[model samples]
Target: MTAGPDRPLVVLVHGAWHRPSTWDAARSALAALGYETRVVALPSAGRDPAPTASMYDDAAVIRKELDQVDGPAVVVAHSYAGIPTSEGLTGATNVAHLIYLAAYLLDDGESMYSRHGMDVPADTTGLFPLMGSPGEALYHDVPRDVAARAVEDLVDQSLLSFTGTVTRAAWHDIPSTYVVCDDDRTIPPALQETMAAHATATRRWPGGHSPFLADPQRFAALVDDIIRSR
Candidate 1:
C-alpha cells in the first residue's frame, strides 16, 4: 500500500495518566510502514506543573505539534485525549482524520464527564484514584506487578482536565475512525459502540483498553490501513 504525500500523518495522542511512550510499539510499526508518527505528550501528563491543566491545555499541546507537521495528519487519540483532539483539530488544515481508540468523543462545548453518566457500570468507579504523585494518577486495571511496572511510565493528570469543556468540535470538520476494544475494562464496549456511532468507520479488536500494548501488531495494522486509505 503506497501512501500519498497528501496522505494523513499519524499522530498518536494518549489520554490521562499516560505518556507518549505508551504508543512506542505502534509508533515503530507505523514508522516501518513508511508513515510518519509523532506522539504528543500533554502537559497534564508531564513532570511539569499541572496547576491549570484543562482539556484546552491538552488541545494546545496537540495544536503545537500539528503545526510542526507538513501535511494533514491522522490523529489517533486514546481515552481522555479524545476530548482535546476533538476540540484541537478545529479549522486545522493539517488534520486529515480523527481516530478514537476507546476514547471520549465529545460534541462542541461538551466535557468528558458528560458521557460518564448512568451508562457506565458501577465497577468502573473502582478503577479511579490510581496511585501516583499528588497531581498524577495511574491506572489500577492491571495486576499489581504489571501495574507497578506501568506506573513508572505514567504521568499526572488533574481532575480539572476532565471537567473542562471542548468549545470547538473537530469531528464536524474532520473525517473520523473509531477502534473499539471488545475486551475494554475501563471504557465499556457498549459505550464504545455508542461513541463510534458518529465515526466514519469502526474497527474492533479483541483486546483490553490498552490494545496498543496488548495487541500492538493488529493496532498498528489498522492505523496503517487508515493512513494508506487516506
Candidate 2:
C-alpha cells in the first residue's frame, strides 16, 4: 500500500444504464493529472438480443482488462458497477486499489436486487430498463445542459446484472476507498455509509449520485488526493 511515483492506470466502471463514454470527462481529467485511464463497457448493457450478460460476465471482462495491464491499476466502480468490479477484482494481482463511488457494495452471495431487502425491479423474464432524466436519478447539481447530454446517452440495462450474485468482494483483500455522495438520489447516503465501514478510507461529497458528471475536475482532484494519501 505504499505510494509510488509511477501512476497506476485508473480503470472506470460505469453503473447501469450507462456506457464507457460516461467517464469521458473523468478520463481526461485523470490523464491531465498524469494517470492513464481505461473505461469498461459492461456487457450487461450491450445490444445483444439474448439475456446473456450478468455480473459475472461484466466482472470477467474487467478481470481480463486487469490481467492485460502491466503494472498496478486502480479500479473505480460507480453505482451498480460496484457489483461487477468487486467480483472482478477478487484475484486481480495487478490491482493496487479499489474505489467505490456511491456504488452497491454487496457481500458474497448478495445480489443488487436484494440490497436493503428490496424487491427486484423486474421479473425473471429478461428486461431492459432506462435511467431517469437529469435530477431524478443523478446530476441534480450539474448544469442542465451537461446533465441533458448525459441523459441523452443513456443505455438500456439488463435485469440479469441485478440478479447475479458476487462470488467475491474485493474490498476484503485490496486497499479500498469509498466515496459517498451525500445527496445521492439513486443509492441513499445512509446505505452508502453502511457499506463505507468496509473500506480502508472513506470520503464524503455533497454531490448527487453522478458526482463525476457534476464536476469531473473536482472529482478527479479528490481521486488524486486519495491516491496521494495512500
Candidate 3:
C-alpha cells in the first residue's frame, strides 16, 4: 500500500532475538488499510559475533526513526520491543499513541529481567540465550512451516537488553493500550495483566504471543481501530 496522508503512520517494533522483517505481514496488512508503516531494527538484535547493544541503544534507534517522520505515528511494540519503545518514545511528540501487543508496560527504572522475576545479571556484556522452544512459545497459533522459519531466523539477544532498565516510561505520558494474549506461553497472561495496570486501557485477545503472525489482517484491523479511536 502506498503512503497516505489521511492517517498516522504505523511503526512496528519487534521483540528480542527477532529481526525487523518479522513485521512484514503486519506491515502489509496495515498498508492495505491505507496506512504507511515502518519497521525498526533494534541494535540489540542480530548483532555480529557477540551481542553488545543494550535496550538503551535500541531505544535510540527507535527514537531516530520517530524523529525522521514528517507527520504523526503510532508505535505498535511486541514483546521485548516494549522496553525500548517505552523509553524511546519519551519526549517524542509525533508519536500520538502506543499499542503494546502482548508486550511489557513497565515503569521508569524497571528492567525486563526484574519484571520477569529474574535477577539482573551483574555482567551484561555476553549474549542472552534463547530459552525453551521459541516456535511453540511464540508462534503456537501460527503455521508449522512459518513458525519453523521464524525460529530459524532467531538470533542471540544481548544480556543488557533484558538486564538494562528504562529511564523513562513513555506510556505514563502518552495514551497507551495493552493487548493481553491469553494463551501466550512466553509471557504469562497473569503477568501481562499486572504490567497492563500502567496502560490507559487494556484488552484481551485469544491467542499466543505472536498474533500478527497468527492473523495479520485481523491484527491490522485491531491496530487501525486503536489508532483511529485515539
TM-score of each: 0.83, 0.92, 0.95
Kindly report which residue stretches of model 2 are placed more than 4 angstroms away from their true locations once superposed: 1-5, 47-50, 119-123, 131-134
For model 1, residues 139-186, the per-residue Cα lDDT tens digits are 333345555656677656666676767787788878898888787777
**lDDT, candidate 3, 102-173, per-residue tens:** 998889878887787788776778788897888888999998888888888898787878877888899878
Each candidate's clash count: 1, 0, 0
Candidate 2 per-residue lDDT over residues 128-211, each given as its tens digit: 566445457787888799888888887667677778877889888899999999988778899999888889999999879987
Give the best candidate by lDDT.
3
Model 2 residue 1 lDDT? 28
lDDT of each: 0.74, 0.83, 0.87
Looking at model 2, the pairs that clash are: none
